[model samples]
Target: MRSKHPPARAAEAGNSTTRQGAASPGVQFLTVPADLAGQRIDNFLQSRLKGVPRSRIYRILRKGEVRVNKGRVKAEYKLQPGDVVRVPPIRTAEQAPAPVAGDQLRQLVEASILYDANGLLVINKPAGLAVHGGSGVRLGLIEVLRQMFPESQFLELVHRLDRDTSGAIMVARKRAVLTHVQGDLRAGRLEKSYLALAVGKWPRGRRLVEAPLRKNTLKSGERMVSVDPEGKPSETRFQVLERFRGATLLAAEPVTGRTHQIRVHAQFVGCPLAGDSKYATDEANRAFREVGLKRLFLHSSVVGCSLPGGQEVRVEAPLSEELESVLAELRSGTGVPLQP
Candidate 1:
């Protein structure tokens, strides 16, 4: 909902320690831009304070170190244009981060570029690379892109791909483009297709799975998803692309994005993905691994969307050589496609 009132604007009193008056060195205030409106408070803070940990930001928010319009707001509060934001003094590393030399990774990603225009970049992300760095990962694809293009003032991920799933991933070069693409995604205007090899033969004809998924974190801190009545709604469409002796190649398209939707859905149908470390059967995985499959046999194959200028853009990424080789071996084996 758009606010009819004037855009929120912030006025900073010089050196105020807190929202109230006290001498503080790092206190500052900023007005939210119209383009930045509707974003969560914590997200805004993360973007503004590039190096700050998300946990620290939430801590400050809990302690009332941050305020908007002279009042404290929850982390989920959406920013309205012209809203004044009071940023409390934050402790940062005294030494600047060492410069990253991302030449090798940058070249690899550059070679994987499928589309770049109108403030959007589409890249065929390589397998085994996290989209963004954290959780024991030193650097990720986004960090490498930042170093790859030093002059780019802004770059953000519009959506995410799992660490092991390789294929088309969107990168927004501008805030407006990010907003536009995200809106399209929410409205189902953007379409994405992924290719996967799942254990067992896939049944013929178009299949749609409308199963709700609930996320669960186990005692060991492993995250998993399952079909639960109380879970959020989820949907995935599947078409059998090929069949092998004991495996099937499938075209999987998720209508609603959820964590591990495709993998979980495949499991729901009793055919977990081949080479899936987290979700596949250990015996099946070992069999596939013995045959030379190293990573999850899933790839983001294609993406389609309409631009603000009425132009339709579609991008595609072919299967990686490693995966294709495995498919060829599977085809030559004893299994055959099921007859219609």
Candidate 2:
């Protein structure tokens, strides 16, 4: 971990800065750097135009106001080194300075590191922490990491976990490592297992669930997923870990990487996750909250994958103290019995 800052820009002419609350005086042409190669154009714009809204960025792309190598390109176009990007004058909303991680948060993040070797870094990501900054979040795990380790040229999330889901999440320190691990993830070679507290007694016979999941966005911009026949194929294997009076602790392994697959599938089987506000019943959430469960009772307990150098890595994150306490109460028969 070196303390050097991010590399400076190398533009053909005028420098680029994220103008806020007003349009730039003139268009700017920027030469893509080697470190940014293979990144999508839209994502590049998002990084360049900090205060600009995502909708406005897409609108600029759709109308061909932004060009790559003096030619119109789609948002998905990957940037190559030395490609000149033409950016038009754009206005953005006035935004406050980006938030910096406090001392406490910095310590917490430092202490949560689970694995770091061969360009792969894993952390026991805390619940309520977003993986990346977006959707009104000023500072996320990735942003904090960049701030902490400024010398790292490339650091990106290999996969995403919901903001409320805590677990062993991977962060790639190099692009090559990211590409290799993500290839494994797409091929179903990366193994992930979660520990979930479901709302009802799980049937012993139901070990595997094959369901298709469809994602829908509400007008409020909230994302929701449900089981649908026309949705993408999904599968999850469930093994009953422990039985409670009205709740069951389950070890869930998703065979397919679908949005909200586990939560939606659990609901489909009439055993939605406890404290899952998006998919579980209010009654169940209320009961679990009363028993000291403040966050979604889902934890990425285990993550196992092979590195590019044929190294095997398996990491497990223990449950947080609050979660462990809730489980202890359930096992002691002291918590309120939840109903299906």
CA displacement after TM-score superposition, residue 82 of candidate 2 (Å) = 9.9
Clashing pairs in 1: 7-82, 8-81, 8-82, 8-83, 9-82, 10-84, 245-335
- lDDT score, residue 291, model 1? 66
Best by TM-score: 1
lDDT of 1 by residue, 149-201 (tens): 88997778778999999999998888777777778998988989999998886
Instruction: Write model 2 residue lDDT over 44-65, tens digit each, in one string.
Output: 8876775666556777898999
Work out the TM-score per prediction: 0.83, 0.82
Instruction: Please report, in order, the local distance difference test score of every candidate based on alpha carbons.
Output: 0.79, 0.83
Q: What is the lDDT of candidate 1?
A: 0.79
Best by lDDT: 2
**Model 2 stretches with alpha carbons more than 4 Å out:** 1-43, 47-88, 92-96
